[model samples]
Target: MYRMYDVVIVGGGPSGATLARLIDQSKSVLIIEKTDEKSISKLCGGLIAPDAQRMLGKFGLFLPKKVLVDPQMFYVESYDLETKNKQRYQRFYLNINRKDFDNWLLKLVDRNVSISRNTKYLSHEYSGDSITIQIEKNGKRDFVESKILVGADGSQSQVRRKTFNDFRYITKYISIQSEIVGGVILPCYEVYFDRGLTDFYGWTIPKNGTNIIGIALQGKDAREKYERYLKNVLGNNFQEVSRRSTVIIRPRRLNDHKTDKDNRVFLIGEAAGFISPSSAEGLSYAFRSAEALAASINSGKNTGKDYRKRSLRIKFNLFMKNIKSIFMYTKFLRNLIFKLGIRKL
Candidate 1:
């Protein structure tokens, strides 16, 4: 007999794990995670917003002090490479260690929730009111059937590709982050905006003991831009550090849920392109999307329709932010906007 699950969630990030925790315990749910360790390393700034704190509180998931690095009233310093001008703005956010934060969320999941680590979703096929999914583990293949399939597997989700092959997604930006060693500590976050350096933005976020320097751009020469930005920031005293790069996706349409001929499937987190267009923030969106997805299922509604409705506010905000970002492409407008000191985040 084939193994069975009422719901199968691919990817064990904030979205996947939270969805599992919100699911009814009586349901036979399975989470397929690619990482073997709970606290897997990830490339992110790991800043939690004030709104995120309330969201976590609603779920009864309180982040311990250990998971948080430090709380600070952060000032964002924006640099214009074209005119060599700098402007400062303040925004309060809590910095955290991505590894520890993820581990904390993972621990909150009920022990009854079945989690298969070191597992990768291969492919899936619909058959007789169920979907048969193929997964790989330890060089071995296994099969499982699920009534509802969820693709929470990041931007480049294998589950989304295999299940929602026709989902229109645009790869908008490429982000590269490097761990800085023996770097000077700064009291606030820094951002660099230069069309020549990158079309998007370059940021330096202070961590517990070190700093994370990264850049997001819209062209094919991401590595070159990243290196140039690093050199510009560090001058001749720049040192080599470990770096990682990943693609950021943006859905062409947020309200549409046409993924081939399947409606029993759902996509959340980066798989559905819930990232912010301006800030490149996804953690908050991931958590919120997971909550929306879980609530829809528990209420006996169409997951896709419910998710589309639930994400309207987020999509609208992203759309407006993208419009605002257009002004940032031009140096004059960007400088003016910074000079005006608009507090809206």
Candidate 2:
């Protein structure tokens, strides 16, 4: 007989973990994570925006001293390659190690919530009113039945592939990041705008005592473009200590969360393509979407309807982001905006 669970969430990242924490303890929740351990480094800039902090605060989560680096005032520095103009602004944001942050979130889950590390969700099938998921661990396979199935896997979500099978639902972009140790310390984070690089942007974020630099783009020669931009910035002093790559999901549908009503399958986080189109910041969306999902399940409402209603603000903001991206990428226009002594971006 297959083990039964009230809710089975695939992927134990922020969205899955947050969802598990928000769900009532009366419900049996199982989080299956492919990683063998909780201390895996995710390819991210590790910058936590104020909105994400606010959401975490609602859940009584504060960045522990061990997990948070020294509180350094954030500064936004943008360089315009077209006119060789630089603009800087004072901003506020916190940085934390993603590996540490994720582990901390996992620990916050209700003790009753079952967590299975090193387990992979192979596939799923719907029968009657329940869903049966095929999972693997240690060269062995098992099946778990759940009333509701949630997919929080990631950009290349297997759950998404199995359910939607639609390639155009969400657009994917390639992102590469490198951690540079023993580099020149900067008091503020920096962003570079170069048409020669990615269509989006490149960033340099200071975390702890090291610098993390990355570029995200939709082009085939993303790495080649990144290298050219790096050469322009470092002038030969660039030395990467470690490198990682990941895909960023850009969901075409900002208003509706993907759900299979008959199959009881739901998607949140990157699996649902909940990510910022401009900044590529996902922590806020992950937490918000998970909260919405939890609320929908708890209220026993139409999950898709609740999710869409709850995400209204996010959808509007994303549309604005799309508008901002247009002017932000233009050479002369961006330089003019920066020269106007306005660095709010």
Instruction: Report lDDT per candidate.
Output: 0.77, 0.79
TM-score of candidate 2 to 2 decimals: 0.93
Q: Work out candidate 2's RMSD over C-alphas.
A: 2.1
Model 1, position 100: C-alpha lDDT score = 79
Q: Model 1 reaches what TM-score against the true structure?
A: 0.91
Per-residue CA lDDT of candidate 1, range 1-345, in tens?
688888999988898999999987888889998886654477777888656777777877767888877545467777887778787766777788888787778778889888998988999888899999999999999999999889888878787777656444464677888888654536678888888876678888877666788888766777787778887786655455678887766544444222212657888877777776667777877888888888777877776677667867767766776786678666778877777876554
* lDDT comparing candidate 2 with the true structure: 0.79
- Per-residue CA lDDT of model 2 for 118-225, tens digit only, reads 999999998777899999999899999999999999777788888887646566778888888644546576888877666678888877777888777778788787
Model 2 residue-pair collision total: 0
Best by TM-score: 2
